[model samples]
Target: MKILAPVSSLSEALPLIESGARELYCGLSPAAWGKEHGDNIWLNRRGPGKANLADLEELEDIVTLAHRKETRVFLTMNQPGYVKAFYPDLVSFVRDTLSIGVDALIMADPGLIKRVKEKEPAAVIHVSSLAAVLNSSSIAFFRSLGAQRIIFPRYLDLRVLRKMIEASEGDLEFEAFVLNDGCVFEEGFCHVSHAFGGAFCHNPAWSYKLREISSGGNKVSQVPAGGESFQQNVDEYKRWLWLGIKNFGGFPGPGGYPLGMCGLCALPELQALGIVSLKIVGREASLRKKAAGVKLVRKTLDLLEAGCSESELRERAGELKGVPGLCRSGYMCYYR
Candidate 1:
């Protein structure tokens, strides 16, 4: 499986390319979209700032640089929905990217996919994980619709993944996350609003408010219905659950991005299953860490390719990355 790393700017392009990221993907926000929508509202998932490319030139430079290395680039326009008024501009965006020689567009919306496909009929399309494609027929349906790839959902189990791969019958490419951030909500199906940016779910304020209500159980231990608390729970978990997620390990450390989450141990299995691209998840990751993440993924892929045994792969993952005992269990692994 090739490494499909994320890039948000021209500065990140070369270092990642050199680190063995053969296919780089990112979200792009053009000047026109930002001007009308305002800078705060992103065209897709990542909320502005450094998470997406600022304009056409940076995108062009990234596309140009990656192409010079013979590395393919895919752009994300994977918003769940766009208003009727957005289509003409969306088509313009697709055409502009096609002009830049973008290899593919990764998006969840079929309507937007149709818009792009109409403009550049030969342009490769990748079904984003946000599409929540859970079945063989669904993938087949996408394949029939001109989608060349599927970014497999983050929480899918190994058995289901194997079944999906079996169903595909070598007709499509699959991209699975191997390292870093994953969604707390099941990625594809969650039509999450980007309230106070896309990091809304990561907001500690939600948990803190519930904590004041003295809520600390898998169920609602505290009732604030008539009070000032705004408590929302999920998977039958209480408010501390987010804190548990943040400081997830039985071991102590910061819970989120800086701490490594890995599926390197499953790489051998994934490759055997014909997954074409194993993704390193963060698009907004720091430049140095992006390079490191790619290098680390490169090492894992190399070790797997060099006939490393599964046990050894796990150990080597710990040695190179994938901090042992933190998210080492199946719940944290992408394929498991």
Candidate 2:
């Protein structure tokens, strides 16, 4: 099993490389909200400036360092929107990336897959989970596009996943998220970002301000503004909160930390299945949290590769138990 760690900052990246992370995913800069990073801009709007994906030199450095330790890297281009809006620049990014000889590209956009085929034909593409290939037809579609592997979405049950793989007719590789948090909103697909801005919202800040409207509305909010601050319509946003749903569970609270053992526990099963990669969700993790999680995952993989038995795997997994969030479904098989 290969472990991929999340790199949120440059400071946290080196240790993960040394620890045994096969791949690391991170933004060009240390922006927590994803606004400052150029990639997020494309997510909001597919047009021109979105091509400023990130610092290529920084990515090269990460590639060089990871290569030194015999690890591969994947750059995510998971934006979902019109192809023509960002196709040209996306093509340029791929061209430059292939020139650097990075490992593979993780993507969800169909337009991107088409462009990659036209520009950097040899580049390997890993279908992002956002594409959610639940059926054999979808899987075949990606395979026909020359996708090397597909990252399965997390919502599928184990039985359905196994069935889908069995029914699929291609030789494409499979990747699954074994650990970390996943939003209810599908990555690379949802339009919540667009509600804030027509095409793009770079580092758009959202604010919560109380106000009074002219028509005697008790509580109103400032108009929704771009560039970082998003003020919800006082009445509208509050009505959303009152709705009985888990979607808004963590509206403004500090999010959960890394789960230490989640990645480690899945290694043995993944190895047994000969899976191509073991990815840990690190997009939002801090460098220290990222490092610790990577270390635990690396240590677990090492033991399992040495022919560790199921009993031993359980014990090792227990020893590296991850940090718990505010709420959880309790102990259960990760794949379940």
Taken over the whole model, the C-alpha lDDT of each candidate is 0.74, 0.59
Compared with the true structure, what per-residue lDDT tens digits does model 1 show for residues 90-198?
8887888889888998988878777777777898999998888888887887887788899887767777888987878556889887876656677666766654544
Worst 10 residues of 1 by lDDT: 249-258
lDDT of 2 by residue, 133-157 (tens): 7777888898888899988876455
Best by TM-score: 1
What's the lDDT for candidate 2? 0.59
Alpha carbon lDDT at 274, candidate 1? 80
Let me know the TM-score candidate 2 reaches against the reference structure: 0.68
Task: Evaluate residue 288 in candidate 1 and report its C-alpha lDDT on the 0 to 100 scale.
Answer: 68
lDDT of 2 at 7: 63
RMSD per candidate (Å) reads: 6.3, 10.2
Error of 2 at 17 (Å): 1.2
